[model samples]
Target: MPPLSEILKTTTTPNGTPWLTSARVGDGYLLRYAGMADFILNGAGSQLTCWRVEPGVSADTIRHLVLDQALPMVLNRRGREALHATAIVTPKGACAFSGPAGSGKSTLPASFFLAGFGALGDDCLPLVEQNGSIQVLPGYPGMRLGRDALEALSAASGVTAPVADYTSKRRALALPSAKNFPREPVLLSRIYRVVRPKEGEP
Candidate 1:
């Protein structure tokens, strides 16, 4: 991996706070997430290397960024449609909830999980087309939820830890009895756009 010479791109939070910087390095790219970790992604999008690590950053925080953000970006570069969505498996197959940040994407899936639905993935749902149908690929074995949503769902027992020190969200395992983490891609059946309720609406 060569040194990141010049930044090709920089991404920010929904509120426009800078978070990630990317530079084209040789045939791949180097991504820098300030105060966390830097990842080197192969041009093929098949390999990821942790090029640098900042002291005191938890492994979980690095993992969260790799899976939830970095991986998705590279996958998109590889021509896969990586949606910012949460996928839940229902009797009808897989349904995805997609929206911008703070739009209940994870919370709605948490509710469905409590109701006995299996989860395919969260926050970076990858989709592949095969044999005339779109399939939803599985992501990490858990989802991240904010403190309030975790309390509302009564799912504290499954929480492994805080997703990162910078946020109040925690990573929680899918319910054991809910057929979690489908080993095979499930056919995508539908998609729903999720949004927060307007003022005075329940």
Candidate 2:
């Protein structure tokens, strides 16, 4: 692992804010959400750039500035569309879950992990084209679960970690209890659309 400065070199745009001098890293890339929005790549020019500031500077903010602002820049630069869902790859194909906030997109995928499926991504799922197939980036090793959702997962999987130990900056759980933690990104597969009914509806 390299230091943040070594791995990422900061540069100031004309307007004057720190942006990454180089962004690409190995098989993956880096998207910086500092003052302004910009994608840094090891290759030539930037894939995208944004002229907005994300909501919060704290690591615990739920309203992700990266997803809200930088994602569009990435999509436009890469010529892709954004999808609001969690993506998991199975033997059959890619599966994606899409719904509004609090619709269980995060918890349902945890169930999949307990069922022996690999963890793809949670919350912000990116759509990418690779090898003639549309693939979504597997999420980093993290899952964001509310109190109730966390308790339910604890019951079913018998895995529990301290809530305080989890950070909002990254969706992560350090569990020495059940020894269940995602180490890698799952392949993109199926797509599931989740819908929650209103106060009264069929």
Candidate 3:
């Protein structure tokens, strides 16, 4: 079950995690974080509110709140599960990679793009059940990577594609537009999880 934040208007510190406290205000949720901006996410997640308590906060912060946090909640309300995964379209079909942070979920999709594949989604991948089978939804047409990560991709064909500003940790680039990476949901063909091999392993 989701948190009862909508009912518990006050008593934010029932526990110790301040970030988890959410209150309802006129059919919306307001989440406050110490030393950071308070985010007011609408019940439907169509609106976002942020009030920065300090400087140096970038607009990307709010974007993440909408894309990664609020949007998922909205999807959940519609009976969908948002997974922390990155997916790409290949000659075979759409493939997704999911794992913890620093698990190369983003980098693997970036590599697929450089290798002449199309990216379907990055960071947040949506899954839905249809006819008793699970399928992956088409997502944003960009991959987020660091500036240094662009070196190899830019040199792939000497075209030197430009990377747009995305977030503090990465750059965003438009993925290829073609039938291979169509902007429509496709049947999930495969999923890979990248992990660090223990030392002494081949």
Per-residue accuracy of model 1 over 73-103 as CA lDDT, tens digit each: 8888889998889988888899999987899
Per-residue lDDT over 80-111 for candidate 2, one digit per residue giving the tens place of the 0 to 100 score = 66677765546665577888767887778766
Ranking by TM-score: 1, 3, 2
Q: Between candidates 2 and 3, name the one with more favorable lDDT.
A: 3
**What's the TM-score of each model vs. the native?**
0.91, 0.54, 0.69
Local distance difference test scores for all models:
0.84, 0.53, 0.64
* Model 2: CA > 4 A from native: 1-57, 62-64, 67-69, 155-170, 174-189
lDDT for 97 (candidate 2): 82
Higher-lDDT candidate among 1 and 3? 1
2 or 3: which has the higher TM-score? 3
Q: Per-residue lDDT tens digits of candidate 3, residues 1-202?
A: 2243454433334355444345675667766544446666667766666644446655665565556555665666556888888888776767889887666788777877767777777777788777777778887766666555666556333323333122345445444442355666777889898886778988
> Among these predicted structures, which one has the highest TM-score?
1
Q: Model 1 — TM-score against the truth? A: 0.91
lDDT of 2: 0.53
Worst 10 residues of 2 by lDDT: 161-170
Task: Tell me the deviation in Å of residue 71 in model 3.
Answer: 1.7
